[model samples]
Target: MATQLIELVDGPLDTGKPSKPKFRTVRKDGQIVKLRIVDADSPNFSADLTASFQANIRRARKENREIEDDS
Candidate 1:
């Protein structure tokens, strides 16, 4: 299975700081999974999360294609 990076964001907590970007890597298995953010309370939480997820998906796909081409 190909490895993929999943980007995520950590929203500001009660301290009221800005959001911080985060990432995780996982194998690209042919299965869907659920992600649960325990306590995200940012105004742009959904938008930020969606953007990060899509960006990482594109990035992972591109990287995988490059690796395949090299083989």
Candidate 2:
């Protein structure tokens, strides 16, 4: 399943804040999955996001079980 990331229409929430939920979407296994990313990639340093983002992702996955939720 090739993943297709949906670029956020609006970038990360509030500048300079690293521990906030940012909306992001990706296509996994031919389905689009929405997420709240709290992690940031690095180019120079390695001390980036923690493991807390997983919880949010897990919850999103659980809440959004169907391919489409018209609610």
Candidate 3:
């Protein structure tokens, strides 16, 4: 299976004195999935981004299981 990446819609997290991590999602075939959190809050903030990410994760998990079965 090929790796899938869900681009984060959020601009960027605020990484100043008190920095909040930015959020991103990644799906790898044989590697552990990872969330890329950066800093730099952008004006473009979408709630769906987070929601979609959750949904993508659920789907990826199912896909992963199937891949394992194939192996």
Instruction: Count clashing pairs, candidate 2.
Output: 0
lDDT (tens digit, per residue) of candidate 2 on 5-47: 9967676443332444456899999999876554445431122
Residue 12 CA error for candidate 3 (Å)?
Answer: 18
Candidate topping TM-score:
1
Model 1 per-residue lDDT tens digits across residues 6-56: 967688434333356554444458655444342367686766666566666
Model 3 per-residue lDDT tens digits across residues 1-71: 99999878678654333234455567688776657453335443344345445567898999999999999
The per-model lDDT (C-alpha) reads: 0.62, 0.55, 0.58
Candidates sorted on lDDT, descending? 1, 3, 2
User: What lDDT does model 2 reach?
Assistant: 0.55
TM-score of candidate 3 on Cα atoms, chains taken together: 0.34
> Distance (Å) between predicted and true CA of 9, model 2?
41
Highest lDDT scorer: 1
Candidate 2: worst-modelled 10 consecutive residues by lDDT:
42-51
Better of 1 and 2 by lDDT: 1
What's the ranking of the predictions by TM-score, best on top?
1, 3, 2
Q: TM-score for each prediction?
A: 0.43, 0.28, 0.34
Q: Candidate 2: lDDT of 19?
A: 45
Q: Candidate 1: lDDT of 8? A: 75
